[model samples]
Target: MVEITLKGITKRFGNFLALDNINLKINDREFMALLGPSGSGKSTLLYTIAGIYRPTRGRIYFDDRDVTDIPPKDRNVGLVFQNWALYPHMTVFENIAFPLELRKVPRDEIERKVREVAKMLHIENLLHRYPWQLSGGQQQRVAIARALVKEPDVLLLDEPLSNLDTLLRLEVRAELKRLQKELGITAVYVTHDQAEALAMADRIAVIKEGKILQVGTPNEVYYKPKYKFVGWFLGNPPMNFVEAEVEGDYLRVYSSRIPVPSHYREIIEKLGIKEVILGFRPHDAQIVKGVGDGLLGEVYSFEPLGREQIVTISLDGVFIKVFAPEEESFTFGEKVTVEIREDRIILFDKEKEVALEYLYKD
Candidate 1:
């Protein structure tokens, strides 16, 4: 395994800049995900790392070795693409052995390695099947096996499970995570799916339009987002942003004013932020009954989401969503109280649209 690093990596296409001064590190044996939305420069960054596209500026390194000018074939990296990239005419055995064959491995050794990886991937039974003969999930395994058969120092995957059905995607995701851990390969996975990154990666570098916003563990990014965009991007149903005016230790959110949490009090006072944006996740707030530290609102709509339900409360003109059990039911215009987890409330600077740091923590 190798520690891959990109220093001030910038990729530009004519007048359009794909990656703007990106600096990231994937530690040895680490599973890191480049996460972002479509056209957010995530796939561009991955391809850059794979030596497929030369960066317009900056350098690439593999464990102190400068490989910025090296070709993709000499990078000692394996890449799996979204479409599987399987050859319809080639059997699974031949496909997996292609990389080894490129290096002139003997037929006996190739057969051994091919069968070994196929069994490891639980596709030994399908070794003779062509790409057209296998299901989506099986084809995905074959693609991954081809990447691993060479024992490449680093593995790069570009939305490898995006084409699979929901259940198959889940199955393949688990297998990939297990294989990476067992092999201890440094892996960089690029995807727009938050759940995939959160589930598989040890660390995630959240990207948006060519710039990285934050890099941290899944819990760190979710619970303590460094920017409002990160907070808004990482959550399901996203976060509810309420415009508020800070006064002393209280914020006048729309028509409801609530005292700021103790943890954020010092920052609020220090910044003397007159106008701020308050953000909290839907699951972090619960419905209460005229309870202390709660906001009163009327239910506007309720969405049933299989395992869980969401209650959209009309907080005056602004709507706030709260998580409820699937069995929980509510009526339109019904009065409801929402108690937010005080410590979990996030304060952001409205002008800069970024999170404000607390001067002191409790």
Candidate 2:
């Protein structure tokens, strides 16, 4: 396993910057994911690390050695793409053994390694099948097995599950995670799917416009987002942001003004922020009664999602969603009091889009 490091990485195409000055360290044997939107430079960074693209400026290091200029073949990295990229005429066994064969492994050793990896990936029974004869998931496994057959120092996957259908994607995702853990391979996985990153990564680097916004565990990024963008990017229903003003010890959201919880008073006071954006997850906003210290909004619509419902409410013309159990139902145009648990409230500077720390008073 090798720790991959990128320092002062920058990439440009003519006048457009594809990747900004980016610095990241991925630990050895760690499953690190680069997640962002389509134009967010996640794939660009992956290709740079894989030696497929030379950076406009920056140095890449594997462990202690600089490999910024190394060729892809000499990097000892296995790259799996979105497409299965299997040879149509070769059987699964021959495809998996192709890499070892290229490396000139003896015939007996190739057979042993091919069977071992095939069994490990649970594709041994399908080894005799041609690429056209196998299902999408099976073909994906064959691609992965081919990548692993060489015992690469690191593995790079660029949206490897995107080609599969929803159910097959889920199945392959589980299998990929299992295989990565079992082999203890240091892997860099690039995906735009937030759920996939949340489920598979030991740590995720959220990127936008070729720069990293934040890098943290799923919980940290979700619950304690350092930036509003990070918070808005990771959740299923996404986070709701309400424009608000900070006054003395309270925040005024729409027509409803509530005192900032006592615990956060010190931080609010220290920051001296007069204007801020209030952020809260859908799950954190609840419906309460009797004009509690919460926003007053009318339900606009509700989407039933099996176990829970996403309730959309309008506060001062701004729509906000709340996740409630299926048992909790609200009707359109119904007046409802929305209670935002103070502890779950995330504050951001509207202009900077950066999270503001809450100072707790004892």
Candidate 3:
């Protein structure tokens, strides 16, 4: 097992800067995920750790050893690409054994290691099958087995499950998490899929535009995001935002005015923030049937999803979604109210677009 660290890491492709002054410490035997959208420099960060792309500036360390100048072959890291790069010409066994063969391991040891990893990945039965003859799931298992056969200290996966079907992806996702824990190996996964990172990683580093926005556990990032972008980027239906202006002790939202909660008043007064953006998750809102101390809106649309439904409400010209039980029914343009959970509401500076620390009272 190894604890990987990247300090002041910066990667530039000529004039285009890919990674900006990145500093992170990946704990030993920890599962860390690099999550971002496409062209967000997540893949570049992974390759840099694998010694495939040398950083323009900064140093990489595995535990206490600085490996800034080390070659990929000497890094002792296992890398699984998005497109499971398996050789179609070779059988699964041969593909898994290729790494050991490169080191000229005795033929007997190579066979033993290949079989061992194949069994671990539950691909032992398909060892004799070529890549062309196997299913996508089987091929991905083979790719993982090939990486694991070398007993690497750190495992790096670049969206390895992106190509698989939903069911197969879930299966592989669970298996990978289980195997990482069972083997006690340090792992770094790169993916833009928020669900995958939330379900699997011990900690997630949310990256955007070659810079890490936030690094925290799943619950921390989901519930108490440091940046407004982090909150907006993580949720399923995404968080809803509404512009508000401080009007005396009340916050004016559209034509309605609601009293400022005691928890947020101090901070708003301290910062003297007049204009702010109020964010609340769909699940954190209560859809009331009548007029009350809440944002007034009308039901615009309904999307039923088995046990629950997403109710879209139009507050004047602004629209927001609310999660309601399936039993709750509403007609088009029906008058309704949305009561945002005051404790769960995230207040952000309208200009800076960053979260305000207003829950300190609790």
Candidate 4:
């Protein structure tokens, strides 16, 4: 296994800056995921590490050796593209064995390795069929098997599960995680899907507009986002943001003013600002039957999602979504009070769009 590092990496396409000055250190055997929306440079960063795209400025290192200028063929990295790029004419066995054959392994060794990888990926039974005859998930498994047959020190996956259907995607995701753990191979994965990254990555690097925004475990990025953009991006229903002003020791949302948690005295004292953004997750706000130390709103709509329900409500002119258990019921236009736990509140600088502090005292 090999640790990978990118230092001061930058890339540009004509007038567009595709990647900013990016730097990251990926530990050996760690499954690091690069996650962002399209045009955010997640794929470009992956290609740079794969030697498919040379950075405009910066260096890439594999373990202790600099490989910024090395050709992809010599980089000893295995890359699986988003498309299952399998040769349609070749049988699955031949496809998986192609890399070993190119490396001049003996015929017996090629057969042995092919069988081993095939079995590990649970595609051993499909070896005699061509890519055209197999399902999308099977073809993806074949592509992965071919990459693994070469025994690369670093594996790079570019949205490897994007082509599969939802159910198949989950199945493949589980298998991919299992394979990575059993092989202990260092991997770098790129994806626009937040759910996939959250479900699969050991640590995720959230990128936006070609710059790294936040890098952390799934929980950190989800619950303790450092920036407003991160809070807006990671969650399903997304975090709710309300325009509010600090009025003395109280925070005013719309016409109602609620006292700030006493524990946050120091943080509030440090901020010393009147205008701020109140950020809280949908799960952090709940519907209550009566008045409470929270905001009052009328339920606008509800979306049922299996065991949980997402309810949208309007406070003043702003809409907020709340996640609740499926058993909870609310009708359209029904009056409801939202209980926002002080400990779960996040305060952000309205101008900078950055988190200022947690609302509650530690």
The residue ranges of model 4 lying beyond 4 angstroms of the native Cα positions read 261-264, 357-362
Per residue, candidate 2 scores C-alpha lDDT tens digits across 1-362 of: 99999999999989999999999999999999999999999888999999999999999999999999899989999989989799998999999999998889999999999999999888999989999999888899899999999999999999999989999998888888988988999999999999999999999999999999889888888888878988888999899999889877778887998777665577778877788888999998788644566899888899999998889999978999998889976777888889888888888888888877622221
Task: For model 1, give the 10-residue run with minimal summed lDDT.
Answer: 353-362
- Can you list the residue pairs that collide in candidate 4? none
Score candidate 4 by TM-score against the native: 0.95
After TM-score superposition, the amount by which residue 272's alpha carbon in candidate 2 deviates from its true location, in angstroms, is: 2.4
Best by lDDT: 3
lDDT of 1 at 275: 88
- Cα deviation in Å at residue 36, candidate 3? 0.5
Write one digit per residue (lDDT tens) for candidate 1, span 1-362. Answer: 99998999999999999999998889999999999999999889999999999999999999999999999999989999999999888999999999999999999999999999999999999998899999999999999999999999999999999999999999889989999999999999999999999999999999998999999999998888888888888878898888888877688877677898898787777766788888999999898644345677888999898999999998886798889888777888887788888889988888777888832231
Poorly placed runs, candidate 3 (over 4 Å): 358-362
Off by over 4 Å in 2: 261-264, 358-362
Clash pairs (backbone) in predicted model 2: 267-359
TM-score of 3: 0.97
Model 1 root-mean-square deviation: 2.1
**Model 2: residue 57 alpha-carbon error in angstroms:** 1.2
